[model samples]
Target: MSSSRYLTNQFLIAMPGLEDPNFFHSVTYICEHNDNGALGLVINRPLEMQLGEIFQHINIEHADPDIRQIQVHLGGPVQQDRGFVLHEPLGDWEATLKVTDRIGVTSSIDILQAIAINEGPERTLVALGYAGWGAGQLEQEMADNAWLSGPADPEILFRTPDAERWRAAAASLGIDLDLLSGEAGHA
Candidate 1:
């Protein structure tokens, strides 16, 4: 596929018609997209877990109550045990995928440590696991109308409340999701 077809630094808003429980009304931030596959993080599904809990599990010291209280999101159904930090400013890290000039997804302890110390990026979204698609899988899903794709906006990823991201992301594309039918059909 050509670069124009790639979805890197985009948002995949799950269509109302999509029945997949894992992605119903989800807003995913596409971090990487290529011929090999696509990788993203679901930004709207917050888990019961918190950053403090993860810090405890990882044996890291988190002294900031605000940072510790930050909710952790369920990024996807895959690798549920792992953690990913979607942050802005793209700081240097051990393992980070630079999605764009301003954003990156890091899966390293160093970033967590920085966050714990109040030295991390200006904004962040912590999540577990990630959404992945094999070669051509995401393209096929797009063709089936399972998702609405558009350029990703950092405001939606970092500042929007989890409950509002789905509609907000769709609205960014001039779509009011509530007005769309829940059933998908081809013309």
Candidate 2:
């Protein structure tokens, strides 16, 4: 696969044919992609718990009701217990993977601490776990039409409602997923 084909900072909109329980109808933000594999966070699946629950679990006291009510997303099926903070303005963080100059995903607790007190990045999407693919695995999925790939849009990531992200992401590519068949074609 050509290096130019790497999907970092892109959106992987699951194809209608993808039947996996974890990814069906999901729109994943590709954070890192290279010869090693791909790492992404599913943006659409919000868990029942809110940010307040996470603060309580981590023993961080926060007084802002707006911050506490933020919905936490289920990023993917992998490492479901770990927290990942995807934020904009890419500030200095302990363990952040800079996907682009504008966005970063931080796993360190310090970012969360700052978040609890409203001193963190201006826009953040807090999630648990992440989507990962081994070397060549994602390429194969692409060839098999498992997803529609396109440049990542911050509006969809930071502002779009969880329930609409799937369609919104596909729409970004001029695709109406509702019209697509749940069957793959071999050209």
Candidate 3:
């Protein structure tokens, strides 16, 4: 595959030995990639907070009794204060990016309100911040083996646990992350 190919709707699974704390053993869903740059959300790094905390912070009273059940992830290293929603059943929102036929990403308060009252998309993953790369940066990372690219699988995104997502995403590509050698050498 060409390193310069558009990666929208694909998954970027971080390889082992990635020392950067923000991306160590991470699985990011590429929402946009092109000549300009690339943007994605790290899908695994769950934070200590949940949707309830977010609603309260934004002055949106949440009625869902299971609000605490929701998870909030650390999307990436940039814009850490903003919220981003990766969801399904693409619906109209103040601002939304249809990442795929089954997935969408929203960065609007209206979507958050819908989620607060249980009227939001059925499958949702809320996150803060997002991973970003300047022009050609992502391709360079790919060439360096910092990440393995794969098709974005919603099952792995919504069904897998936070700590297991990285490995699970890699598994989808028939890769056992445990077996990857950290040393840069070919046998």
Candidate 4:
């Protein structure tokens, strides 16, 4: 680990009129930030699939009543078939990656099973994909005004309704989505 962490657990709010079909109006939760690059989940994009559907596909018994009704989110463009669970801070799982003091991400089946049984972290968001960038790619995009960065709010990550997450995330940075423009250039 680097002595200085970049922006782990921050929110990467998409600028208005962004042309990227995958990220327009997106609110991403940074899971890892280092020299290797960054990884995040797009919190506002919802797919047609549900959590129960995913569990069944993986042969994991969905015995817990609570998770059956949960909606699965489109985390990003990478590994669309994989599962990533962003949850309230609980005891560390074998494969858990601590994004912040308050949040943890678990990508292993054991965590999924624990979640299926209601033995997992109390607050959680299930995603089926993730956003990633090569070295310096994210920084270049940020420099081009492709994204706005802000502190991540746990409430926004786990409790805010999907439709509202984008605006909510932008609002956290004092940015009004309606006032933003996509064109990027030197002033």
Model 3 Cα lDDT, one tens digit per residue, 114-187: 88778899899999999999999998888787888889889888889888998899888888889986653211
Q: State the local distance difference test value for candidate 3.
A: 0.87
Q: Which candidate comes out best when scored by lDDT? A: 2
| RMSD in order of candidates | 1.6, 1.6, 2.3, 2.3
C-alpha positional error of residue 88 in candidate 3 after TM-score superposition, expressed in Å: 0.4
What TM-scores do the predictions have?
0.96, 0.96, 0.94, 0.92
Error of 1 at 169 (Å): 0.3
Better of 1 and 3 by lDDT: 1
Better of 1 and 2 by lDDT: 2
The list of candidate 3 runs beyond 4 A from truth reads: 1-4, 184-187
Please report the TM-score between candidate 1 and the true structure.
0.96
Give one clash count per candidate, in the order shown. 0, 0, 0, 0
Evaluate model 1: give its lDDT: 0.93
Which residue runs does candidate 4 get wrong by more than 4 Å? Answer: 1-5, 184-187
- What number of backbone clashes does candidate 2 have, counting pairs of residues 3 or more apart or in separate chains? 0
